[model samples]
Target: MELAKRIQPTMTRQEQEQRDRKAASNRQLTALLGKIAIYVVTTTLAIIFIAPWAWMVSASFQPIGDIFDWPPSWIPENFTLNNYTRFFEEANIGRLVLNSTLVAGSVVIAQLFLNSLAAYTFAKRRFPGRNLLFVIMLGALMIPGQVNLIPAYLILQHVPLAGGNDILGNGGHGWLDSYAGLIVPSLSSIYGIFLLRQYMKSIPDDLIDAAKIDGAGHFRIYWQIVLPLCGPALAAMSIFTFTYHWNDFFWPLILITSESLRTLQLGLALFVVRNRTVWDIVMAGSVIATLPILVIFLLFQRYFIRGISLTGMRG
Candidate 1:
């Protein structure tokens, strides 16, 4: 009886400890399940978002006939560089790439400089109608881009003595069919200015004041004090600007009539005109067009993430 009683008490204590550990484990699992679910869901959505582009890349390696196989195959059974071969063979891919690079690069560089300057002015400098002007610019973002297209096209079309026009901008194509048209309209961006301005407001006033006390002029203060501090914002804006103009179809299409001047996206569209069923080459060109931007994104992703977070918080 004494042995039985001692053994029973020891067993009960062990069982109690086991129960407590299980309860604690269950609670942890329940909390962890919520986080795990979120991770799973977000990861799934990321994959879904990437699937089409992934498929496009995969199909680019496959033959034209195999693109629409019974089951969509990411890995091609018979891989060939024919699509890339045909891309170069059919289109002036080299010239198109050069044009796109020139256009996108110019836009990115110019927009960063001009917009940063304007944003700094808006954020730091005292000026008349500053707030009103900013509001107007914000409103511009709301307006459909197409709303101003006709007027912009008319201006380029009618500019004097440019393409072949007389003194009245009526002799020839003004900026139309030229690099000026492609770059000029895209250089100024209201959205970029706003993004930078919002991000700049987060910077403390003492920094600028300290610079001012150090005998820095407005421009110098801006260049030295503000620009370096806003690197993340600038990087993010550059990415957006580069990507937007790189993939721009409608504006470049309207401006560039020459195949030599056609951007990569425009040249790729020509493939659709030539053959709807020939998606392999189209996808090949797409992948080519996508690579630089993708690489750029990967490189600047950290800056982009920080910029976006800060801009969102302040704006």
Candidate 2:
């Protein structure tokens, strides 16, 4: 009887251990299945988003006829460089690229400087009505940009002492059809200021105080200390600013008239011949127009992601 008792207890212990092992294995399997599901969903989403761009790139290489083939070939049937060569030959691509580069670069630099300065003041300096001002600025974001277009046009068009305007701002196309028109209005972006402000708020106040103790002026501290630390945020703002201004069609269409002043987006519109659309030329131009932004984004992607995340964490 004692022998049987001992044997029964041993068997029970073995069964319990087996059950524990089975439970662990089941948990591991469930976790693995969940991971696979997540990967599958993400991969599907990536493909869906990337397919259009892939088609665009593929079509850019194919002949116009192949681009419109019944089945819509993803791969080029007759690969040719005619589209690109024709685009470069027909369009003053060099001038368009220069104009766009000039405008976008100017806007990025100005916004970085002006917005960061305003952001630093709003973030660190204590003054009355600061919060109210910031609220007003944020509120401006809610207002559609189109709503301000007319007002901006009127203001720029009649600016006193600009573009041959008299004291009353009523003369020779104040800022119309000029680089000034394109670059000036975009000098300070409210969204850029807000982004930089949020990021700057995360910086320790103690650093600013230390700089002051050493007799560093506000400008010195802002330039030497705060600006360096805000590199990621600035990088993000630059990319956004550059991309927006570079691709902006409506504003330039309204503001610019001279062929010399036409931006890349405006130049692309030229591809739309009177009634018919030149799909091949459009594709080629799009590929060209997209390259700079793509390069810029790829280079600053790390900073852009980090800036967006950290800026939101504190504010």
Candidate 3:
């Protein structure tokens, strides 16, 4: 009886260990399955997002006939530059690219300068009604840009001393069909100012004070000290401004009348008009237009994220 009791306790101990091992094995399997499911779901989502761009890139190389194949080819069976060749031949693609680069480039440069300066002033300086002014500026963000289009158009149309407008701004078309019209109204970017302001506030005040102690003027301090420190913010703003302006269709469509002055977005519209649509050539143009933005984002992605992170932090 004593021997049997001792053997029974040993058996119970072994059973407990077996149960523990089995439970641990079951947990590991469950965890592995969960991880696999997560990876599969995320990978599927990635493919879904990437498919359109992949198709766009693939279709750009496809001949016009192959573009409409029943199953929709993800990879071109045979590649040809005919779509690209036709794009260049039929459209002023080079000129359109030039126009887009020029306009987007100019806006980026001007916005960097103007927005950084305004941001520095708002962040570091104390002036009368400063908070009120800033609040009003932020309030503008709540209003839809489309809502201000008419007012902006009227203002641009009636500007004095340029575009042949008299003192009353009631003569020739003020900046109409000109680069000035395209660029001027865009120069005062409240969003850019706000973005830069948040970033600049994070900069240490000691640096600005030290510069002031050296008898540096506000412009000198702003240019030499503050501006250089704002590289990441500037890059982020430049990319955003460039991308937005590059893809701007409505503003350019409304303002620009001459075909030669048309931006890339407007020029691409010539593909799908009245009765005809050229899918292959249109896809090629899309790829061309999209390539710059992708390249810019890839190059400056880190800086862009850093700038956004800095903006979220307090001074």
Candidate 4:
């Protein structure tokens, strides 16, 4: 009887140990399955988004005859440079690229300076109606840009002593068909101000105070200290501003009528319309148009990500 009692206790301990091992194995299995599921979902999403661009790139190289073949080959059977060569041959690519670069660059630089300045004031300065004004500005974002489009155009059209307009703000085309018209309306963005304001709020007030103590004026402090510290945010804004203006179509189409001042997007649209039947060449143009955006993103990606991550941390 004594031996049986001792044996029973030993059996119970062994059974408990077995149960614990089984439970641990089950947990590990469940965790592995969860990881696999997450990977599968992520990979599927990546492929879905990347497939269209991959196909477009492939189609850009395929011969014109092979572009619409059955089964939709991802790899071209007949690779040719004819489409790209023909694209340059038929379009004023250099002029279009130059116009796009100029417009986008101007907008990016102007937005960075103007928006950051406004953002600094909103963030660091104390003034009456500051919050109210900020809220009003943010409210503008909720309003559809289309709602303000006509008003903006009219304002630009009637500027006194500019673009052949009289003091009464009516006489000629005003800003219509001019670079000033294309650029001025986009010089400052409410969204940009909001973004930079949020980011700037993360900056310590001690720095600004110290700069003032050292006899630095607001602009001097902003130009020397604040601007350098806001590199990440500035990079983010530059990428955003450049991309938007570079790919802009509707605004430019409505604002510009002169062929000489036409942007890349405008030229691309005309190219598409003119070569509706030649899809391969169209794809080549698209590829070229997309390159600048890719380059800009690649150059600023690290800063952009850091800026976005830190933007709302304090505010």
Q: Whole-model Cα lDDT per candidate?
A: 0.88, 0.87, 0.85, 0.87
TM-score per prediction, in order, is: 0.88, 0.88, 0.90, 0.89
> Model 1: per-residue lDDT, tens digit, 1-315?
345446567567667677668878999999999999999999999999999989999999999889989889889889999999998988878998999999999999999999999999999998889999988888777888789999999998987788898998886888999988999887879888988998898899998999899899999988988999988889999988888999889998788897778899988887778888788889888898889988988998897777677657755
Candidate 3: Cα lDDT at 133? 95
Q: What does each candidate score in C-alpha RMSD?
A: 4.7, 4.1, 4.3, 4.1
Estimate the lDDT of model 1.
0.88
Evaluate residue 134 in candidate 1 and report its C-alpha lDDT on the 0 to 100 scale.
87
Minimum summed lDDT over a 10-residue window in model 1 is located at 1-10
Clashes within 3 Å, all models in order? 7, 0, 0, 0
Please report the candidate that would top TM-score against the real structure.
3
Extract clashing residue pairs from model 1: 159-169, 160-169, 164-171, 164-172, 165-171, 165-172, 166-171
lDDT of 2 by residue, 154-195 (tens): 988998888899999987789988899999999999889989
Residue 124 lDDT (model 1): 93
Residue pairs clashing in model 4 are none
The list of candidate 1 runs beyond 4 A from truth reads 1-18, 28-43, 313-315
lDDT tens digits, residue span 1-315, model 3: 346446667567667677668878999999999999999999999999999989999999998789899899888998988888888988889999999898888888888888888888899898998999999988888998789898888887888877789988989678777788888777758888888888788789999899999999889988999889888788878878888999999888888888888899888875557216688888888898888988988999897777667655532
Q: What lDDT would candidate 3 get against the real structure?
A: 0.85
In candidate 3 the C-alpha lDDT for residue 170 amounts to 80
Which stretches in model 3 have alpha-carbon errors above 4 Å? 1-11, 161-167, 308-315
